[model samples]
Target: MTPHEIGTTFYAYTAASSSVAHILDASKPATFSMVNAHKRLAILIHGFTSSHEDSHLQSIKTNMLHHSNGEVGTVIVVDWRHGASALALPPYLRAASNTQVVGHQVAHLVEELRKHHGVNPHNVYIVGHSLGAQSAGFAGRYALSTFHWKLGRITALDAAAPSFENHPGTFLTKNDAVFVDAIHTSASKDHNPLNGVFGFVHAFAHLDFYPNDGHNQPKCHNPLEIACHHEAALLYYDASLSAHNSCKFYGFSCHDWATFHAHHCTKHDAEMGYFADKIHASGVRFLATTEKYPFCH
Candidate 1:
């Protein structure tokens, strides 16, 4: 699908001034007069059938604003709703095909930010969920191949498994960024119907976190527990953004939950979400959370 047909839009926000926000028009890029070049730039991308206004994205935006604390930072929320909302038969498949267009567009935006606003590509942090996560990989790859830009970090929240699971060069991978991390909360084991899930059960990042066994999340009693499980990834991430360490999730390196529960993986190897240790955190990791909100233990 073409970009014009997809109709992507960008919304820029600076914590310092609500009045200085950038809006709907694609022709007018956000002016970073208040934001300095070296400051962190966060780009939050929502999944298929989701928009920039999704609660998960908004939570991160709010949390980022709090973390930056009126500092010189920019949080740009991408909305490709038109592309994500295809109404034809097999709509999800159609939406899945449009992710590449969105990714290239994001790369273009990053190039502009670096060229015109003095923003550093290495300072950019990409946050995306499901299909959005897949797009983030594409964005990272496009930036590197087309513009020679290596993004600093990319966090995939339970990256969608349907269209991307085993597809080479079509899914999120560790090579997408300098430090790519993934939080798998609702991973599926399609091999057994009883253990079906929504996310890929494979390790797709330099650091992969499978919280609560990566499926059957606690406190999920919905009729479709799978959905509740799928959503827990973002919520867990959102809670980890709190100022208080009580909610900040610290994970341990382990082969699996059984190994983690065996009391072998005791030391906290890395913190999840915003505070992730880009230095030491690598390979497969596991963590536990409460059955309710403020899940971190």
Candidate 2:
């Protein structure tokens, strides 16, 4: 659909939803523990085959709030029903309907939030990890086309670079997201063509390549890890926190990690601990009240 058309739909959706007194109540903080009353809204998109608890999502949410002062704003963690078999999908079909559907769902959700709580579209930002990055890209594009949604930023952390490679320019309009930024990690051992293609895009505002060899860092092969950070997702996010605040874009990889070996989750936890602390210091703005992890002070 044309971008203008999409924007109209988004506006109508938000307005209709707002008229319901219970809509805001339905979106209560209990719905998303970290969400607060006054702060702006930030949506968290999980990587492919991953959940909100994934390290990358956790790290980004932690970091953004860290930089914003314990008040990181509202985080809406998106979860899709795509089966775990996405790993097995012939690369071609993976980007087809799945990408469009998820993007639409997120857009719809944003409208609901905007109308219900008077959230400013310009203040809304989406931080996506892995496949979630692709979701952020599509959502941003949809919003841009509709014109009703203007964002502070859409940060794609090592976004799913492969699935969108061959799609027509319709998916990516020129300068579509002026405020959009991306970060990619070269340290990842995954050799997928899509990943390579995704890395080539000039859309990335900032790119950080990690060392190819490091102690304790594992290869980017585990499906769960690949699903989350096969190329060490959280670690990549940790390295990209210091840049300016315009719709962050970051990528990461570790040194000497193979695309076959396995690593433990604690290894990820350690990385997150450091990132969480750094975000708290970076001045990213967040909503008060502890949810998953206390906003590092």
Candidate 3:
């Protein structure tokens, strides 16, 4: 078996003190030589209060290192300059309130990647979760309009519906990527219909919904449930493996938290780790197929 190779690139940014809006970041082009050369390039943005190595992106990076056929690729982790110094949850909430700034940072990074590495626009992919997802969408929009940088695909994993819905350009209708797919965890009971995200739901080239509330993903400490949702996302993403089909939606069910909490299911951090990995694997499969590969080569 080939050993997996992985590397990280950091981006620096300056934003208004009041909001984390990206002002300027120009050093991204210098970091491409540090990336692994065996897989498709992946740009992973961490959510607010999270590190560049957050579990969401790290797990996927691990998977790609091992699974990518002899061609390793770059994984750029965009660290919010002040994000590391702030409290995790609270700042995430505050920062998420305005995601366009982060998106601007992503747009800058993408341009640098193109100019420095000469990466084909169609070979790059963006992956994000929650606020990060919103950032990915924002970046995709900016890239399209400014550079006409078409992407192979963009995947938003269980993104918070706030920026996704309320913002016009975040969804496909506003500035659709060459390919866009979203997986919103059904774990939230408060999916306000009045919110723009609900309306934006229909714009994804492909969309997936879990049966549980936004917080109730598999491994709400239940291995069985985790396996199920993992399988569901895997299958849903796999449907596009042939590259001939357009995007679609998959609605899956995991144990609802209301029931889990009501029944007092034993909560284990270990179990949560399991499910997170499963979900990440599902994401990896989706990403692998979206690029130009030997199968499509």
In model 1, the worst 10-residue window by lDDT is 18-27
TM-score for each predicted model, relative to the true structure: 0.91, 0.56, 0.57
* Best model per TM-score: 1
User: On residues 1-297, what C-alpha lDDT tens digit does candidate 1 reach at each position?
Assistant: 689888888777777653344753434445545445768888888887889889778877877777644432778889998888847547778878888989888888888777777888888889988888988999999999999979998999988888788788999888889989899977867623234366778998988888888886876876544467777888887887754355668888776799997888888878887777444868887888888778887
State each candidate's clash count: 1, 42, 14
Give stretches of model 1 more than 4 Å off: 18-21, 24-35, 68-72, 191-196
RMSD of 3: 13.5
Tell me which of candidates 1 and 3 scores higher on TM-score.
1
lDDT per residue, candidate 3, 168-196, as tens digits?
A: 55543224455555554432345553321
